[model samples]
Target chain A: MIKLKEALVIAEAALKMARIRQLNPMSVAVLDARGCLVAFQMEDGSSLLREDIAKAKGLSALALGMGTRALVGRAKHHPAFFVGLSALSKGNMIPVPGGVLIRSPLDAAIVGAVGVSGDLPDHDEACAIAGIEATTYSWDAGADPS
Target chain B: MIKLKEALVIAEAALKMARIRQLNPMSVAVLDARGCLVAFQMEDGSSLLREDIAKAKGLSALALGMGTRALVGRAKHHPAFFVGLSALSKGNMIPVPGGVLIRSPLDAAIVGAVGVSGDLPDHDEACAIAGIEATTYSWDAGADPS
Candidate 1:
Protein backbone atom coordinates (compact mmCIF):
# COMPACT_ATOMS: atom_id res chain seq x y z
CA MET A 1 0.00 0.00 0.00
CA ILE A 2 1.15 3.54 -0.68
CA LYS A 3 1.91 5.78 2.29
CA LEU A 4 -0.57 8.59 3.00
CA LYS A 5 2.18 11.22 2.85
CA GLU A 6 3.23 9.99 -0.55
CA ALA A 7 -0.36 10.04 -1.74
CA LEU A 8 -0.83 13.64 -0.62
CA VAL A 9 2.35 14.78 -2.26
CA ILE A 10 1.35 13.08 -5.48
CA ALA A 11 -2.06 14.74 -5.43
CA GLU A 12 -0.65 18.18 -4.69
CA ALA A 13 1.91 17.94 -7.44
CA ALA A 14 -0.82 17.08 -9.92
CA LEU A 15 -2.77 20.21 -9.01
CA LYS A 16 0.32 22.39 -9.19
CA MET A 17 1.20 21.11 -12.63
CA ALA A 18 -2.34 21.78 -13.79
CA ARG A 19 -1.95 25.39 -12.73
CA ILE A 20 1.40 25.75 -14.42
CA ARG A 21 0.01 24.33 -17.64
CA GLN A 22 -2.95 26.77 -17.66
CA LEU A 23 -5.49 23.99 -17.24
CA ASN A 24 -8.70 24.70 -15.36
CA PRO A 25 -8.38 24.64 -11.62
CA MET A 26 -8.96 21.03 -10.63
CA SER A 27 -9.62 18.75 -7.70
CA VAL A 28 -7.79 15.49 -7.17
CA ALA A 29 -8.30 12.42 -5.06
CA VAL A 30 -6.16 9.39 -4.35
CA LEU A 31 -7.59 6.11 -3.12
CA ASP A 32 -5.92 3.01 -1.72
CA ALA A 33 -6.44 -0.57 -2.88
CA ARG A 34 -9.75 -1.14 -1.08
CA GLY A 35 -11.23 2.06 -2.56
CA CYS A 36 -10.55 4.14 0.52
CA LEU A 37 -9.45 7.76 0.08
CA VAL A 38 -5.77 8.31 0.85
CA ALA A 39 -5.70 12.03 0.16
CA PHE A 40 -7.82 14.70 -1.55
CA GLN A 41 -7.65 18.41 -2.43
CA MET A 42 -9.65 20.89 -4.47
CA GLU A 43 -8.07 24.03 -5.85
CA ASP A 44 -9.70 27.27 -4.79
CA GLY A 45 -11.37 27.99 -8.13
CA SER A 46 -12.57 24.48 -8.86
CA SER A 47 -16.25 23.76 -9.03
CA LEU A 48 -18.12 22.67 -5.94
CA LEU A 49 -18.82 19.28 -7.47
CA ARG A 50 -15.16 18.65 -8.29
CA GLU A 51 -14.49 16.90 -4.99
CA ASP A 52 -17.28 14.39 -5.47
CA ILE A 53 -16.38 13.80 -9.08
CA ALA A 54 -12.71 13.23 -8.28
CA LYS A 55 -13.51 10.85 -5.44
CA ALA A 56 -16.06 8.81 -7.38
CA LYS A 57 -13.70 8.49 -10.29
CA GLY A 58 -10.88 7.27 -8.05
CA LEU A 59 -13.22 4.87 -6.25
CA SER A 60 -14.37 3.43 -9.55
CA ALA A 61 -10.81 2.85 -10.64
CA LEU A 62 -9.90 1.14 -7.38
CA ALA A 63 -13.06 -0.96 -7.16
CA LEU A 64 -12.88 -2.15 -10.75
CA GLY A 65 -9.10 -2.66 -10.70
CA MET A 66 -8.58 -0.69 -13.90
CA GLY A 67 -8.25 2.86 -15.07
CA THR A 68 -11.66 4.52 -15.19
CA ARG A 69 -11.08 5.42 -18.84
CA ALA A 70 -11.11 1.73 -19.63
CA LEU A 71 -14.40 1.44 -17.82
CA VAL A 72 -15.82 4.14 -20.07
CA GLY A 73 -15.48 1.83 -23.04
CA ARG A 74 -16.95 -1.06 -21.10
CA ALA A 75 -19.71 1.17 -19.86
CA LYS A 76 -20.67 2.13 -23.37
CA HIS A 77 -20.84 -1.51 -24.39
CA HIS A 78 -22.77 -2.62 -21.32
CA PRO A 79 -24.75 0.41 -20.32
CA ALA A 80 -27.14 -1.55 -18.13
CA PHE A 81 -24.44 -3.06 -15.95
CA PHE A 82 -22.71 0.26 -15.80
CA VAL A 83 -25.83 1.94 -14.53
CA GLY A 84 -26.28 -0.88 -12.07
CA LEU A 85 -22.79 -0.22 -10.74
CA SER A 86 -23.74 3.34 -9.90
CA ALA A 87 -26.64 2.11 -7.79
CA LEU A 88 -24.59 -0.68 -6.27
CA SER A 89 -21.99 1.72 -4.98
CA LYS A 90 -24.66 4.07 -3.69
CA GLY A 91 -23.91 6.54 -6.47
CA ASN A 92 -20.17 6.55 -5.86
CA MET A 93 -18.92 4.61 -8.90
CA ILE A 94 -18.27 6.82 -11.92
CA PRO A 95 -17.12 5.18 -15.15
CA VAL A 96 -15.16 7.91 -16.89
CA PRO A 97 -11.75 9.10 -17.84
CA GLY A 98 -9.45 11.02 -15.44
CA GLY A 99 -9.12 8.11 -13.00
CA VAL A 100 -5.86 6.21 -13.41
CA LEU A 101 -4.57 3.21 -11.51
CA ILE A 102 -1.11 3.54 -9.97
CA ARG A 103 1.29 0.57 -10.02
CA SER A 104 4.41 0.06 -7.94
CA PRO A 105 7.63 0.86 -9.78
CA LEU A 106 9.57 -2.11 -8.37
CA ASP A 107 7.14 -5.02 -8.78
CA ALA A 108 4.30 -3.50 -10.84
CA ALA A 109 1.76 -4.27 -8.12
CA ILE A 110 -1.36 -2.13 -7.87
CA VAL A 111 -0.69 0.49 -5.21
CA GLY A 112 -3.61 2.91 -5.59
CA ALA A 113 -5.18 5.35 -8.07
CA VAL A 114 -5.55 9.08 -8.67
CA GLY A 115 -8.65 10.91 -9.98
CA VAL A 116 -8.78 14.43 -11.36
CA SER A 117 -11.73 16.65 -12.19
CA GLY A 118 -12.78 20.23 -13.01
CA ASP A 119 -11.64 20.34 -16.66
CA LEU A 120 -12.36 18.68 -19.97
CA PRO A 121 -12.28 14.89 -19.84
CA ASP A 122 -8.99 14.66 -21.71
CA HIS A 123 -7.43 17.43 -19.69
CA ASP A 124 -8.53 15.85 -16.46
CA GLU A 125 -7.03 12.56 -17.60
CA ALA A 126 -3.75 14.26 -18.43
CA CYS A 127 -3.55 15.74 -14.94
CA ALA A 128 -4.16 12.33 -13.33
CA ILE A 129 -1.44 10.73 -15.46
CA ALA A 130 0.93 13.54 -14.65
CA GLY A 131 0.22 13.13 -10.94
CA ILE A 132 1.02 9.42 -10.94
CA GLU A 133 4.18 9.98 -12.93
CA ALA A 134 5.34 12.53 -10.36
CA THR A 135 5.39 9.74 -7.80
CA THR A 136 7.58 6.65 -7.87
CA TYR A 137 4.50 4.72 -9.01
CA SER A 138 3.51 4.45 -12.66
CA TRP A 139 0.12 4.82 -14.28
CA ASP A 140 -1.51 1.54 -15.37
CA ALA A 141 -2.66 2.18 -18.94
CA GLY A 142 -2.31 -1.46 -19.99
CA ALA A 143 0.96 -0.68 -21.95
CA ASP A 144 1.00 3.00 -22.80
CA PRO A 145 3.69 4.92 -20.95
CA SER A 146 1.96 8.25 -21.66
CA MET B 1 -27.02 19.79 8.75
CA ILE B 2 -23.39 20.28 9.66
CA LYS B 3 -21.47 22.68 7.43
CA LEU B 4 -18.52 21.48 5.41
CA LYS B 5 -15.99 23.52 7.38
CA GLU B 6 -17.16 22.05 10.66
CA ALA B 7 -16.96 18.57 9.25
CA LEU B 8 -13.38 19.06 8.10
CA VAL B 9 -12.31 20.40 11.48
CA ILE B 10 -13.94 17.47 13.26
CA ALA B 11 -12.22 14.92 11.02
CA GLU B 12 -8.83 16.62 11.42
CA ALA B 13 -9.08 16.63 15.19
CA ALA B 14 -9.96 12.95 15.22
CA LEU B 15 -6.94 12.15 13.10
CA LYS B 16 -4.69 14.36 15.24
CA MET B 17 -5.76 12.42 18.34
CA ALA B 18 -4.94 9.15 16.62
CA ARG B 19 -1.43 10.44 15.93
CA ILE B 20 -0.88 11.85 19.43
CA ARG B 21 -1.90 8.56 21.05
CA GLN B 22 0.49 6.59 18.82
CA LEU B 23 -2.31 4.45 17.47
CA ASN B 24 -2.52 3.01 14.03
CA PRO B 25 -2.93 5.65 11.37
CA MET B 26 -6.62 6.18 10.71
CA SER B 27 -8.93 7.39 7.96
CA VAL B 28 -11.93 9.48 8.90
CA ALA B 29 -15.04 10.48 6.97
CA VAL B 30 -17.84 12.95 7.59
CA LEU B 31 -21.07 12.71 5.67
CA ASP B 32 -24.17 14.79 5.43
CA ALA B 33 -27.58 13.48 6.47
CA ARG B 34 -28.28 12.58 2.86
CA GLY B 35 -25.14 10.42 2.90
CA CYS B 36 -23.02 12.72 0.77
CA LEU B 37 -19.43 13.18 1.86
CA VAL B 38 -18.62 16.57 3.35
CA ALA B 39 -14.96 16.04 4.17
CA PHE B 40 -12.50 13.20 4.53
CA GLN B 41 -8.87 12.55 5.49
CA MET B 42 -6.61 9.56 5.97
CA GLU B 43 -3.50 9.43 8.09
CA ASP B 44 -0.02 8.87 6.60
CA GLY B 45 0.05 5.07 6.95
CA SER B 46 -3.54 3.83 7.08
CA SER B 47 -4.39 0.89 4.84
CA LEU B 48 -6.36 1.13 1.62
CA LEU B 49 -9.38 -0.50 3.25
CA ARG B 50 -9.77 2.24 5.83
CA GLU B 51 -11.45 4.62 3.37
CA ASP B 52 -14.21 2.25 2.33
CA ILE B 53 -14.73 1.05 5.91
CA ALA B 54 -15.07 4.57 7.23
CA LYS B 55 -17.50 5.73 4.51
CA ALA B 56 -19.68 2.63 4.79
CA LYS B 57 -19.87 2.92 8.55
CA GLY B 58 -20.89 6.56 8.31
CA LEU B 59 -23.50 5.83 5.65
CA SER B 60 -24.86 2.96 7.75
CA ALA B 61 -25.24 5.26 10.72
CA LEU B 62 -26.98 7.91 8.61
CA ALA B 63 -29.34 5.43 6.99
CA LEU B 64 -30.15 3.32 10.06
CA GLY B 65 -30.95 6.19 12.43
CA MET B 66 -28.43 5.01 15.05
CA GLY B 67 -24.78 4.41 15.72
CA THR B 68 -23.15 1.48 13.94
CA ARG B 69 -22.34 -0.21 17.26
CA ALA B 70 -26.07 -0.38 18.03
CA LEU B 71 -26.66 -1.89 14.63
CA VAL B 72 -24.18 -4.64 15.46
CA GLY B 73 -26.58 -6.18 17.99
CA ARG B 74 -29.42 -5.94 15.54
CA ALA B 75 -27.28 -7.41 12.80
CA LYS B 76 -26.51 -10.44 14.95
CA HIS B 77 -30.18 -11.14 15.43
CA HIS B 78 -31.03 -10.56 11.77
CA PRO B 79 -27.98 -11.59 9.88
CA ALA B 80 -29.83 -12.28 6.66
CA PHE B 81 -31.55 -8.92 6.69
CA PHE B 82 -28.33 -7.16 7.52
CA VAL B 83 -26.58 -8.82 4.64
CA GLY B 84 -29.42 -7.86 2.35
CA LEU B 85 -28.86 -4.25 3.27
CA SER B 86 -25.40 -4.45 1.74
CA ALA B 87 -26.98 -5.30 -1.58
CA LEU B 88 -29.64 -2.66 -1.11
CA SER B 89 -27.10 0.08 -0.55
CA LYS B 90 -24.68 -1.33 -3.09
CA GLY B 91 -22.22 -2.50 -0.38
CA ASN B 92 -22.21 0.78 1.57
CA MET B 93 -23.76 -0.61 4.74
CA ILE B 94 -21.29 -1.70 7.40
CA PRO B 95 -22.78 -2.52 10.78
CA VAL B 96 -19.69 -1.90 12.87
CA PRO B 97 -18.40 0.30 15.62
CA GLY B 98 -16.87 3.71 14.79
CA GLY B 99 -19.96 5.06 13.06
CA VAL B 100 -21.76 7.70 15.09
CA LEU B 101 -24.59 10.02 14.17
CA ILE B 102 -24.32 13.75 14.82
CA ARG B 103 -27.26 15.80 16.01
CA SER B 104 -27.69 19.52 15.98
CA PRO B 105 -26.95 20.98 19.40
CA LEU B 106 -29.94 23.29 19.46
CA ASP B 107 -32.75 21.44 17.69
CA ALA B 108 -31.36 17.94 18.04
CA ALA B 109 -32.06 17.24 14.41
CA ILE B 110 -29.89 14.79 12.57
CA VAL B 111 -26.93 16.64 11.09
CA GLY B 112 -24.58 13.97 9.92
CA ALA B 113 -22.33 11.16 11.09
CA VAL B 114 -18.59 10.56 11.47
CA GLY B 115 -16.79 7.29 10.72
CA VAL B 116 -13.26 6.27 11.71
CA SER B 117 -11.16 3.21 10.90
CA GLY B 118 -7.56 1.90 11.02
CA ASP B 119 -7.40 0.95 14.69
CA LEU B 120 -9.04 -1.30 17.25
CA PRO B 121 -12.82 -1.14 17.03
CA ASP B 122 -13.21 0.46 20.43
CA HIS B 123 -10.36 2.84 19.79
CA ASP B 124 -11.88 3.86 16.49
CA GLU B 125 -15.14 4.55 18.25
CA ALA B 126 -13.37 6.71 20.80
CA CYS B 127 -11.81 8.81 18.07
CA ALA B 128 -15.15 9.29 16.36
CA ILE B 129 -16.80 10.29 19.60
CA ALA B 130 -14.01 12.66 20.39
CA GLY B 131 -14.45 14.30 17.01
CA ILE B 132 -18.16 14.90 17.43
CA GLU B 133 -17.55 16.32 20.92
CA ALA B 134 -15.07 18.76 19.48
CA THR B 135 -17.78 20.14 17.25
CA THR B 136 -20.86 22.09 18.26
CA TYR B 137 -22.87 19.11 17.12
CA SER B 138 -23.66 16.45 19.70
CA TRP B 139 -23.61 12.70 19.26
CA ASP B 140 -27.07 11.38 18.64
CA ALA B 141 -27.87 8.14 20.48
CA GLY B 142 -31.42 8.11 19.07
CA ALA B 143 -32.71 10.27 21.89
CA ASP B 144 -34.00 13.82 22.22
CA PRO B 145 -31.25 15.84 23.81
CA SER B 146 -33.12 19.03 23.14
Candidate 2:
Protein backbone atom coordinates (compact mmCIF):
# COMPACT_ATOMS: atom_id res chain seq x y z
CA MET A 1 0.00 0.00 0.00
CA ILE A 2 1.22 3.49 -0.83
CA LYS A 3 0.69 5.42 2.38
CA LEU A 4 -0.74 8.89 2.24
CA LYS A 5 2.36 10.39 3.79
CA GLU A 6 4.54 9.05 1.00
CA ALA A 7 2.10 10.15 -1.64
CA LEU A 8 2.13 13.67 -0.27
CA VAL A 9 5.89 13.61 -0.17
CA ILE A 10 6.07 12.47 -3.76
CA ALA A 11 3.69 15.18 -4.91
CA GLU A 12 5.50 17.91 -3.04
CA ALA A 13 8.86 16.80 -4.37
CA ALA A 14 7.55 16.78 -7.92
CA LEU A 15 6.28 20.32 -7.56
CA LYS A 16 9.54 21.43 -6.04
CA MET A 17 11.50 19.97 -8.91
CA ALA A 18 9.30 21.70 -11.42
CA ARG A 19 10.07 25.01 -9.76
CA ILE A 20 13.78 24.37 -9.64
CA ARG A 21 13.84 23.40 -13.29
CA GLN A 22 11.90 26.51 -14.28
CA LEU A 23 9.20 24.48 -15.94
CA ASN A 24 5.72 25.78 -16.47
CA PRO A 25 3.32 25.71 -13.55
CA MET A 26 2.30 22.08 -13.19
CA SER A 27 -0.37 19.74 -11.88
CA VAL A 28 0.55 16.47 -10.20
CA ALA A 29 -1.50 13.49 -9.17
CA VAL A 30 -0.62 10.46 -7.06
CA LEU A 31 -2.75 7.36 -7.26
CA ASP A 32 -2.63 4.07 -5.45
CA ALA A 33 -2.54 0.78 -7.31
CA ARG A 34 -6.31 0.62 -7.50
CA GLY A 35 -6.31 3.94 -9.40
CA CYS A 36 -7.75 5.78 -6.41
CA LEU A 37 -6.56 9.31 -5.96
CA VAL A 38 -4.24 9.75 -2.99
CA ALA A 39 -3.14 13.34 -3.39
CA PHE A 40 -3.28 15.97 -6.10
CA GLN A 41 -2.21 19.58 -6.58
CA MET A 42 -2.49 22.02 -9.45
CA GLU A 43 -0.24 25.02 -9.55
CA ASP A 44 -1.67 28.46 -10.10
CA GLY A 45 -1.89 29.52 -13.78
CA SER A 46 -2.10 25.97 -15.03
CA SER A 47 -4.81 25.44 -17.60
CA LEU A 48 -8.12 24.08 -16.34
CA LEU A 49 -7.81 20.64 -17.95
CA ARG A 50 -4.36 19.96 -16.49
CA GLU A 51 -5.84 18.22 -13.46
CA ASP A 52 -7.84 15.78 -15.56
CA ILE A 53 -4.85 15.09 -17.77
CA ALA A 54 -2.64 14.42 -14.80
CA LYS A 55 -5.13 12.02 -13.25
CA ALA A 56 -5.68 10.28 -16.56
CA LYS A 57 -1.98 9.74 -17.04
CA GLY A 58 -1.68 8.16 -13.62
CA LEU A 59 -4.72 6.00 -14.17
CA SER A 60 -3.35 4.86 -17.50
CA ALA A 61 -0.12 3.76 -15.91
CA LEU A 62 -1.98 1.75 -13.31
CA ALA A 63 -4.46 0.23 -15.72
CA LEU A 64 -1.84 -0.97 -18.18
CA GLY A 65 0.80 -2.02 -15.64
CA MET A 66 3.31 0.15 -17.48
CA GLY A 67 4.36 3.72 -17.59
CA THR A 68 2.54 5.82 -20.13
CA ARG A 69 5.81 6.29 -21.99
CA ALA A 70 5.84 2.65 -23.04
CA LEU A 71 2.25 2.76 -24.15
CA VAL A 72 3.01 5.52 -26.63
CA GLY A 73 4.61 3.22 -29.20
CA ARG A 74 1.95 0.57 -28.74
CA ALA A 75 -0.74 3.18 -29.18
CA LYS A 76 0.86 4.36 -32.40
CA HIS A 77 1.20 0.88 -33.80
CA HIS A 78 -2.31 -0.23 -32.81
CA PRO A 79 -4.53 2.78 -33.11
CA ALA A 80 -7.74 0.79 -32.99
CA PHE A 81 -6.73 -1.00 -29.82
CA PHE A 82 -5.68 2.25 -28.22
CA VAL A 83 -8.96 3.85 -29.18
CA GLY A 84 -10.92 0.95 -27.73
CA LEU A 85 -8.88 1.06 -24.55
CA SER A 86 -9.44 4.76 -24.21
CA ALA A 87 -13.17 4.28 -24.56
CA LEU A 88 -13.22 1.37 -22.13
CA SER A 89 -11.35 3.41 -19.57
CA LYS A 90 -13.60 6.40 -20.18
CA GLY A 91 -10.72 8.42 -21.62
CA ASN A 92 -8.32 7.81 -18.75
CA MET A 93 -5.71 6.03 -20.83
CA ILE A 94 -3.47 8.79 -22.02
CA PRO A 95 -0.32 7.23 -23.44
CA VAL A 96 2.21 9.92 -22.71
CA PRO A 97 5.60 10.37 -21.14
CA GLY A 98 4.66 11.96 -17.85
CA GLY A 99 2.96 8.97 -16.33
CA VAL A 100 5.28 6.80 -14.22
CA LEU A 101 4.71 3.68 -12.17
CA ILE A 102 5.88 3.49 -8.58
CA ARG A 103 7.23 0.23 -7.26
CA SER A 104 8.68 -1.17 -4.07
CA PRO A 105 12.46 -1.25 -4.12
CA LEU A 106 12.62 -4.50 -2.19
CA ASP A 107 10.48 -6.72 -4.38
CA ALA A 108 9.49 -4.50 -7.31
CA ALA A 109 5.84 -4.67 -6.33
CA ILE A 110 3.55 -2.09 -7.83
CA VAL A 111 2.67 0.45 -5.17
CA GLY A 112 1.34 3.52 -6.90
CA ALA A 113 1.97 5.89 -9.77
CA VAL A 114 2.47 9.58 -10.45
CA GLY A 115 1.30 11.78 -13.31
CA VAL A 116 2.41 15.31 -14.06
CA SER A 117 1.38 17.99 -16.52
CA GLY A 118 2.06 21.62 -17.52
CA ASP A 119 5.51 21.25 -19.04
CA LEU A 120 7.02 19.51 -22.03
CA PRO A 121 6.54 15.76 -21.93
CA ASP A 122 10.21 15.09 -21.24
CA HIS A 123 10.32 17.66 -18.49
CA ASP A 124 7.15 16.29 -16.97
CA GLU A 125 8.59 12.79 -16.97
CA ALA A 126 11.79 14.08 -15.42
CA CYS A 127 9.84 15.70 -12.63
CA ALA A 128 8.03 12.45 -11.96
CA ILE A 129 11.35 10.57 -11.77
CA ALA A 130 12.83 13.19 -9.45
CA GLY A 131 9.92 12.83 -7.10
CA ILE A 132 10.15 9.04 -7.00
CA GLU A 133 13.91 9.14 -6.56
CA ALA A 134 13.55 11.35 -3.50
CA THR A 135 12.26 8.31 -1.60
CA THR A 136 13.23 4.67 -1.27
CA TYR A 137 10.67 3.59 -3.83
CA SER A 138 11.62 2.66 -7.37
CA TRP A 139 10.01 3.99 -10.53
CA ASP A 140 9.46 2.90 -14.10
CA ALA A 141 8.98 5.44 -16.83
CA GLY A 142 8.40 2.58 -19.33
CA ALA A 143 11.59 3.06 -21.30
CA ASP A 144 13.31 -0.11 -22.31
CA PRO A 145 16.13 -0.92 -19.91
CA SER A 146 18.42 -2.17 -22.68
CA MET B 1 -13.22 34.35 -12.12
CA ILE B 2 -11.83 32.09 -9.42
CA LYS B 3 -8.06 32.35 -9.50
CA LEU B 4 -6.15 29.18 -8.78
CA LYS B 5 -4.44 30.91 -5.86
CA GLU B 6 -7.75 31.62 -4.17
CA ALA B 7 -8.92 28.11 -4.95
CA LEU B 8 -5.86 26.64 -3.26
CA VAL B 9 -6.37 28.86 -0.25
CA ILE B 10 -9.96 27.70 0.04
CA ALA B 11 -9.03 24.05 -0.19
CA GLU B 12 -6.31 24.38 2.44
CA ALA B 13 -8.56 26.27 4.78
CA ALA B 14 -11.26 23.63 4.48
CA LEU B 15 -8.75 20.88 5.23
CA LYS B 16 -7.47 22.79 8.24
CA MET B 17 -11.00 23.16 9.53
CA ALA B 18 -11.61 19.45 9.10
CA ARG B 19 -8.53 18.70 11.18
CA ILE B 20 -9.46 21.21 13.86
CA ARG B 21 -12.94 19.78 14.18
CA GLN B 22 -11.66 16.19 14.22
CA LEU B 23 -13.78 15.26 11.26
CA ASN B 24 -12.82 12.39 9.02
CA PRO B 25 -10.18 12.93 6.41
CA MET B 26 -11.75 14.95 3.64
CA SER B 27 -11.49 15.70 -0.03
CA VAL B 28 -12.05 19.27 -1.27
CA ALA B 29 -12.59 20.44 -4.82
CA VAL B 30 -12.90 23.97 -6.13
CA LEU B 31 -14.48 24.71 -9.48
CA ASP B 32 -14.78 27.82 -11.55
CA ALA B 33 -18.24 29.03 -12.57
CA ARG B 34 -17.78 27.07 -15.78
CA GLY B 35 -17.56 23.99 -13.59
CA CYS B 36 -13.93 23.46 -14.47
CA LEU B 37 -11.67 22.18 -11.73
CA VAL B 38 -9.26 24.77 -10.38
CA ALA B 39 -7.86 23.11 -7.32
CA PHE B 40 -8.40 19.84 -5.48
CA GLN B 41 -6.90 17.82 -2.66
CA MET B 42 -7.78 14.54 -1.04
CA GLU B 43 -6.52 13.89 2.43
CA ASP B 44 -4.67 10.60 2.77
CA GLY B 45 -7.23 8.71 4.77
CA SER B 46 -10.23 9.76 2.74
CA SER B 47 -12.08 7.08 0.84
CA LEU B 48 -11.42 6.64 -2.88
CA LEU B 49 -14.85 7.94 -3.79
CA ARG B 50 -14.51 11.14 -1.80
CA GLU B 51 -12.80 13.08 -4.59
CA ASP B 52 -15.53 12.19 -7.07
CA ILE B 53 -18.18 13.10 -4.54
CA ALA B 54 -16.51 16.40 -3.79
CA LYS B 55 -16.29 17.38 -7.43
CA ALA B 56 -19.86 16.25 -8.08
CA LYS B 57 -21.12 18.36 -5.24
CA GLY B 58 -19.38 21.43 -6.56
CA LEU B 59 -20.64 20.73 -10.07
CA SER B 60 -24.16 20.25 -8.73
CA ALA B 61 -24.12 23.65 -7.10
CA LEU B 62 -22.80 25.29 -10.24
CA ALA B 63 -25.24 23.48 -12.52
CA LEU B 64 -28.29 24.44 -10.45
CA GLY B 65 -27.12 27.95 -9.55
CA MET B 66 -27.61 27.25 -5.86
CA GLY B 67 -25.86 25.65 -2.98
CA THR B 68 -26.44 21.92 -2.69
CA ARG B 69 -28.07 22.48 0.69
CA ALA B 70 -30.95 24.21 -1.00
CA LEU B 71 -31.37 21.39 -3.46
CA VAL B 72 -32.09 18.68 -0.95
CA GLY B 73 -35.70 19.72 -0.36
CA ARG B 74 -36.31 20.28 -4.04
CA ALA B 75 -34.76 16.96 -4.91
CA LYS B 76 -36.86 15.17 -2.36
CA HIS B 77 -39.99 16.84 -3.68
CA HIS B 78 -39.10 16.29 -7.33
CA PRO B 79 -37.23 13.03 -7.35
CA ALA B 80 -37.77 12.38 -11.04
CA PHE B 81 -36.40 15.75 -12.03
CA PHE B 82 -33.37 15.36 -9.81
CA VAL B 83 -32.74 11.90 -11.22
CA GLY B 84 -32.94 13.14 -14.75
CA LEU B 85 -30.67 16.05 -13.96
CA SER B 86 -28.13 13.69 -12.45
CA ALA B 87 -28.20 11.53 -15.53
CA LEU B 88 -27.86 14.49 -17.82
CA SER B 89 -24.88 15.71 -15.82
CA LYS B 90 -23.20 12.32 -16.03
CA GLY B 91 -23.91 11.74 -12.34
CA ASN B 92 -22.51 15.05 -11.14
CA MET B 93 -25.71 16.47 -9.62
CA ILE B 94 -25.50 15.33 -6.04
CA PRO B 95 -28.17 17.29 -4.16
CA VAL B 96 -26.69 17.55 -0.70
CA PRO B 97 -24.96 19.96 1.56
CA GLY B 98 -21.16 20.56 1.46
CA GLY B 99 -21.48 22.14 -1.94
CA VAL B 100 -21.41 25.91 -1.40
CA LEU B 101 -21.44 28.52 -4.11
CA ILE B 102 -18.78 31.18 -3.89
CA ARG B 103 -19.83 34.70 -4.70
CA SER B 104 -18.11 38.00 -5.17
CA PRO B 105 -18.74 40.33 -2.25
CA LEU B 106 -19.11 43.29 -4.59
CA ASP B 107 -22.05 42.08 -6.70
CA ALA B 108 -22.82 38.61 -5.35
CA ALA B 109 -21.87 37.21 -8.73
CA ILE B 110 -20.84 33.63 -8.41
CA VAL B 111 -17.10 33.21 -8.76
CA GLY B 112 -17.07 29.49 -8.23
CA ALA B 113 -18.12 26.73 -5.84
CA VAL B 114 -16.43 24.53 -3.27
CA GLY B 115 -17.30 20.95 -2.42
CA VAL B 116 -16.09 18.92 0.54
CA SER B 117 -16.66 15.28 1.48
CA GLY B 118 -15.69 12.64 4.07
CA ASP B 119 -17.63 13.80 7.10
CA LEU B 120 -21.19 14.40 8.19
CA PRO B 121 -23.03 16.51 5.66
CA ASP B 122 -23.38 19.37 8.12
CA HIS B 123 -19.72 19.26 9.05
CA ASP B 124 -18.70 19.17 5.44
CA GLU B 125 -20.82 22.21 4.73
CA ALA B 126 -19.33 24.01 7.69
CA CYS B 127 -15.83 23.37 6.44
CA ALA B 128 -16.75 24.65 2.98
CA ILE B 129 -18.22 27.78 4.54
CA ALA B 130 -15.17 28.31 6.68
CA GLY B 131 -12.94 28.06 3.63
CA ILE B 132 -14.94 30.56 1.62
CA GLU B 133 -15.22 32.92 4.60
CA ALA B 134 -11.46 32.91 4.98
CA THR B 135 -11.35 34.89 1.79
CA THR B 136 -12.95 38.19 0.94
CA TYR B 137 -15.55 36.39 -1.13
CA SER B 138 -19.01 35.42 0.16
CA TRP B 139 -20.74 32.04 0.01
CA ASP B 140 -24.27 30.63 -0.29
CA ALA B 141 -25.04 27.33 1.36
CA GLY B 142 -28.53 27.31 -0.10
CA ALA B 143 -30.41 27.99 3.11
CA ASP B 144 -33.37 30.38 3.05
CA PRO B 145 -32.13 33.84 4.00
CA SER B 146 -35.03 34.59 6.30
**Clashing residue pairs found in predicted model 1:** A88-B90
The model with the greatest lDDT is 2
**Model 2, B33-100: lDDT tens per residue?**
87877777788767769989999999999998999999888888889999999899999999889999
Candidate 1 backbone overlaps, count: 1
RMSD of each: 5.6, 2.3
Which CAPRI quality tier does the interface of model 1 achieve? acceptable
Recovery fraction of native interface contacts for candidate 1: 0.40
- Against the correct fold, how does model 1 do in TM-score? 0.66
Candidate 1 chain A: 10-residue stretch with minimal lDDT = A137-146
Candidate 2 stretches with Cα past 4 Å from truth are A144-146, B144-146
Instruction: Report, for candidate 2, the interface RMSD.
Output: 2.5
Tens digits of per-residue lDDT, candidate 1, B1-146, equal: 66755876788788878877878989888877777666678987666577789988898888878888887777778899988999998888887788889998788788889888989877888888888888878885332222
lDDT of 1 by residue, A24-64 (tens): 87878888776668776665545557878998888788877
